[model samples]
Target: MSSDESQQRRGSYVPIDFTPEVSKQCLKQVEFYFSEFNFPYDKFLRMTAEKNDGWVPIGTIATFNRMKKFRPVEKVVEALRTSKILAVSEDGENVKRIEPLDLEGTKNARHERNKRTVAVMNFPHENVTNMTELQEKMEEFFGKLAQINQVRLRRERGRKFNGTVIVEFKDLPECEKFLKTYSGEDAETLSFEGRKLDVFTKKQFDLQREATRGKNFSGSGQKARSFTGHRKNMPQQEQKDENKEEQKEETSKEEETKVEDKD
Candidate 1:
C-alpha cells in the first residue's frame, strides 16, 4: 500500500457504517492529528463541544475543522465524548449542555453531587395492573427513592411522555442508594418491576429536555447552525411535536415567573 494509504490504516480507521466519503475524510483528519501532529483527540472533542455550547454537531464540527460537511462525524466524535479524560464546563441541550455528564476531572464526584434527580426512561405511561400502580411501585421500588421531592411523568392524550420519569431525590445519600444498586452506562436502561427503564441523572434529563426544544446549540453570541449534520429533511410531524413541547415549556416558565413576581 502507498504511504498515505498506510497512514489511513494505521492507529485509526474510519467506521464502516459512515458514508464512504465522509468517513474517509474524517478518519484522514483524525489520523493526521493523532499520528502526524500527535494532537490529543479528546482535547479536540472537548473544544468542539465547548464551542457548540456543550453539544457537538457533526457537520458544524467539520466546518470548525475546515473540513467538508455531509459527513456524519458523530460516530467518530462518540469516541472522544465517551473518553474519560474530558471535562464538562457547562450544560446546553440533550445534544446541548452535556457538560452535566462530560465533566473532565471529577466525573464521579459531579455525578455524586447530582443527587437532585434521577431519570427513568421507557417507563409505562400508566401501570396496566392498576391506574396508580406506577406511583405505588415507585414508592417501594428503591428503599429511599420513594422520598423524593417530586415526580414528573409527563404524557399527552395519545402520545407517551417519551415514557421518561424524572424523579428528584430528597437528598444525596438517597440517590447514592439508587445509583449503587442500578446505575450502568450513561442513561443505561435497567429492568424494574417487569419493565425495562433507562436510568440517568436529572442533569442528563435536562440535557434531553433542552435538545427537545429544537433550538440551535451554538454558544452565546455565535450564529446557530443546522442541527441535522447531513441536512436531511426533518419530518413535518416531528417538527410540530417539537414546537408543541417548546410552547408548553415556555408557558410553564412564564406562569412560574408570574407567580414568583406575585409573591
Candidate 2:
C-alpha cells in the first residue's frame, strides 16, 4: 500500500468480515460461556464442567467436613428450574437466577461455611453487636458467601462498631477470596445496607514455634565460628610449641615405620 493508504488505515476503525464459519464460531463461543464456570456453583442450580479452567483433586473438596456440595451446572440449573429459582435462554447463551440471598430467610440457615477464617471491620454501629444479630447482618451482607457454609462474625472489644466483624470461613481459599474482593481503600467500595465499610482482613499465623525450631539447643547468641582468617590471636610461643608437638608426632610415626620395615 501507498504511504497515504497506510496512513489512512492507521487511524481508521475496521470491522471483521462475518463469514459463515466465523459466525458459527461466535455462536458456539457464546454458548460455551453460559455452560461453563469455575468453583462454587450453587447446589440449587445445574452446572456443567464440559470446559473448565482447572480442577481440584477428587478428594480435596469432598473430604472437607462442612463445604457446600457442588454438582454439574446441568444438574444445578435443572433443580433450580424445578424449584423456580433459575431462568435461561432458548439458545442456551444466557442465564438468570436468584441467589441464596434473594431467597427468604436463608441468612439464618445452619449450614457450615469454610474451615479457614478471615476478619473484616469498619461496619456501621447500627444492627451490630457482639451477638447473633451481628452474625446475621454480616451473613445478609456477604450474600452467597454467607450461605455456602457457616459464617462466624464476632464483635470486637470496642464501641466503634455495633458490629465490628471477625469473619471466619471454612477454608483458606474462601478467606483469601473474601479479603481480595472486599478489603482495601478502593471505592465505590463494598457496603452493607446503605453504609460503606472499611474492610479489614484477619490473618492467622503460628507464633509458638520452639526456640530451636526442631533442633536441640537453648542459648541466647550464636556459637563460635568454624573458620577464621588470622593466626594473630595465638600467643607466638604457644603456637610454636603446638607446631613442635605435631612435628614430633610425625617423626615418631616415621621411626615406627622404619622399625617395621627392618622387622
Name the lDDT of candidate 2: 0.34
Question: Where does the lowest 10-residue lDDT sum fall in candidate 2?
Answer: 218-227
Candidate 2 lDDT, 1-263, residue by residue in tens:
99999975653333344455544433332232222121122221223322222212222221221111222223323332332433444443334432323222331121222124443434555543334345445556665654323343322233224233445554667666666776544423666666555444332100111112243111111211100123122233322254554454233223211001111
Q: Give the TM-score of candidate 2.
A: 0.28
Residue 181, model 2: Cα distance from true site in angstroms: 1.4
User: What are the clash counts of all predictions, listed in order?
Assistant: 10, 25
Residue 215 C-alpha lDDT in model 2 = 34
List ranges where model 2 is wrong by over 4 Å: 1-115, 126-131, 146-148, 156-162, 185-188, 204-263
Q: What are the per-residue Cα lDDT tens digits for candidate 1 across 19-49?
A: 5555555555433322211122135545765
Candidate 1 has an lDDT of 0.43
Top candidate when judged by TM-score against the true structure: 1
Please provide TM-scores, in order, for all candidate models, with all chains considered together: 0.33, 0.28
